[model samples]
Structure formats: C-alpha cells, structure tokens
Target: MTPHELETILTEIGLSNSALARHVNRSEGNVRQWRKGVSKIPDDVAEWLREYHYFFQKNPPPQRKG
Candidate 1:
C-alpha cells in the first residue's frame, strides 16, 4: 500500500507510529520513513498490518445484550 493508505489505516485503527513500530518490531524512525514516503513499507510489515485489520473486522468483540 502507499504511504497515505498505510497512514490512513493506522489512523483509523487509532495506532500511533510508535505503537506500530513496536508491533512490527521496527524502529520508530522506520515508521516515520514510511509515513513520510522516504521508503516503502516492506511487504511483511504491510501484510502484518493488513492481517490485524482483517482480524479485528472479522471477529469483533461480543456485545452486551441489554
């Protein structure tokens, strides 16, 4: 995905760059580079984020039945 798309997804998930970096096991500066479009986000990293998005969307938390 493009940097803008990646940034948008992260924002939608309420994840900061530092958080993403920690999850992806990369340095915060690496995330910043991706956000700034200095370098492409690696395929593995992108896949990791996509998987997280899919998991959350597919299996949402159970709701209280009031």
Candidate 2:
C-alpha cells in the first residue's frame, strides 16, 4: 500500500507509530520510514498488515467501526 494509505490505516486502527511498530514487531524507525514514504514496506510487513486488516475487518476494535 502507499504511504498515505498506510497512514490512514494506522489512524483508523488507533495506533501511533510506536504502537504500530510494537504490534507489527518492526522497528519504530521502519514504521516512521513507512509513514514518511522514505522506504517501501517489505513484503513480510505488508503481508502482516494485510492479515491484520483482515482480522480487523472481521472484528474491529471497540472504538472503531466500519
């Protein structure tokens, strides 16, 4: 996904960069790079995000809705 899309997802998911990095088991620097469009998200990280998106679509967090 594009950086803007990723940032929107992150906001929709109610996660800051640090929280997202922790959730995805990636470095905060990597998350920052992704958010800034400084680096492309790796395949594995993209897959993880997709999976997370799938689960989230199925069962969103209490504070968020479709």
Candidate 3:
C-alpha cells in the first residue's frame, strides 16, 4: 500500500504511529517514516494493515474498562 493509504488505514483504525508500530512489531520512527513518505511501506507491513483493517471491520475490539 502507498503511504497515503497506510495513513488512511491508521486513521480508520484509530491508531497513532506509536500504536501501529507496536502492532506491526516495528519502531515508531519507522512508522513515522512510512507516514511521511521518507521511506516506503514494506510489503509485509501493508499486508498486515490490510488484514488488520479487515479483521477490525468484522470484529471490533472491546473497549477497555477503566
């Protein structure tokens, strides 16, 4: 996926760079690079995002009890 598309997915999933980095097993700086177009989105990361989008659509996560 393109950087713009990744950014859109991140927004849709309500995750910031820090959260997405953790989910994808990457560093926040890496996510920032992808978001800013300083580096391309890795193929695996794109696929993970796609899968996450699909899964989240089908099964939204439960809210945290605070």
Candidate 4:
C-alpha cells in the first residue's frame, strides 16, 4: 500500500504506530518507515491492515474501565 493509504487506514483504525507494530509482529520503526514512505509495506501487512480497518469500523473497541 502507499504510505498515504497506510496512514489513512491507521487513522481509521485509531491505532498508534506502536500498536500496529505489535499487532503485525513488526517493530515500531518498521511501521514508521512504512508510514513515511521510506520502506515498502508488505502485501500481507497491507491486507491485514485493511481487514483490521473493516473490523474496527464495524466493531469499535470497548472503552477501558477507569
């Protein structure tokens, strides 16, 4: 995916770079690179992000107890 698309998806999912990195089993730096267009986003990661975005839209996460 293009960096712009990746950034948009991440925003839609409401996930920080660190959170995405954890979910995708990658380093935060890797996610940063993808977001910045410094590195290519793998096809698998892009696919997973798209799926996650859909899930996030349909079933937003529950609020944390405080």
Candidate 5:
C-alpha cells in the first residue's frame, strides 16, 4: 500500500505511528519509515492491517458502561 493509504487506514482506525509500532513489535523508527515511504510496507503486514481494519469497521468495540 502507499504511504498515503497507510495514513488513511491509521486515521480510520485511530492508531498513531507509535501504537502501530507497539502492536507490531517494531521500533517507532520503523513505523515512521513505513509511514514516510522510506521503507516498503510488507505485503503480509498490509493485508493483515486491511483485514483487521475491515473487521474493526464492521464490529466496533462496545461502548464502556461508564
């Protein structure tokens, strides 16, 4: 996926670069590289993100009983 596409997906999912790095067990620097197109986003990672994003969109987390 393109950097812009990644940015959109992250925005849609409310995930910051640091949070994505933490989730994938990568360094923040790596995530930045992906975000900036300095490094290519792996196919597997991209597909995984798309799948989870679709799932998240369809089945949002329940609101807390505040």
Candidate 6:
C-alpha cells in the first residue's frame, strides 16, 4: 500500500509510529521514514499490515469489536 494509506490504517488502529514499529518489529526510524515519505515500506511490511487489517476487520479483538 501507499504511504498515505498505511498512515491512515495506522491512525485507524490507534497506533503511533513507535507502536506500529514495535508491533512489526521494525525500527521507529523506519516507520518515521515511511510516514515522512523518505522511504518505501518493504513488501513484507505491507503484507503484514494487510494481514492485520484483514484480521481486525474480520475478527477484531473482543473489546474493540464489541
């Protein structure tokens, strides 16, 4: 996905760059670079985010969905 799209997803998930970095095991600088458009997200990272989006949409955490 595009950087903006990723950013939107991050926002929807209520995570900052640091939180997302922790979730994905990436560096905070990498997340910041992606957000700043200074770097592109790797395919694996994109896939991870897509999976997360799907999981949450289809089977969100009980508290969040409920």
What does candidate 1's lDDT look like per residue over 12-61, in tens digits?
Answer: 67789899999999999999999999999999999988888788778866
| lDDT of every predicted structure (CA atoms) | 0.89, 0.83, 0.90, 0.92, 0.88, 0.86
Of 2 and 4, which scores higher on TM-score? 4
For model 4, state the Cα shift of residue 21 in Å.
0.6
Give the per-residue lDDT digits (tens) of candidate 6, residues 1-66. Answer: 788989888877678888889988999999999988899999898998988877777876667553
Q: Per-candidate RMSD vs. true structure? A: 2.2, 3.6, 2.7, 2.5, 1.8, 2.5
Candidates in order, TM-scores: namely 0.83, 0.77, 0.83, 0.84, 0.84, 0.82
Name the TM-score of candidate 5: 0.84
Residue-wise lDDT of candidate 4 within 1-66, one digit each (tens)? 899999899888778999999999999999999999999999999999999888888998898999
Candidate 2 matches the true fold with a TM-score of 0.77
Instruction: Give the range of the ten consecutive residues with the poorest summed lDDT in model 2.
Output: 6-15
Per-residue error for 3 in candidate 4, Å, reads: 0.6
- lDDT score, candidate 2: 0.83
What is the lDDT for 57 in model 2?
Answer: 79
lDDT by residue (tens digit), candidate 2, 3-53 = 987887776767788988888788999999998999998878777777777
lDDT of 3: 0.90
Q: Higher lDDT: candidate 1 or 6?
A: 1
Residue 39 lDDT in model 1? Answer: 92
- lDDT (10s digit) by residue, model 3, range 1-66: 888899888888899999998888999999999998999999998998999899988899897998
lDDT of 5 by residue, 1-66 (tens): 999989999999989989988877788898899999999998877887898799999998889896
**Residue 29, candidate 4: alpha-carbon lDDT:** 97
Query: Model 4: how far is 59 from its true place, Å?
Result: 2.3
The clash numbers for all candidates, in the given order, read: 0, 0, 0, 0, 0, 0
Q: Is candidate 2 or candidate 5 better by TM-score?
A: 5
Order the candidate numbers by lDDT, best to worst: 4, 3, 1, 5, 6, 2
Clashes of 5: 0
In model 6, what is the error at residue 30, expressed in angstroms?
Answer: 0.7
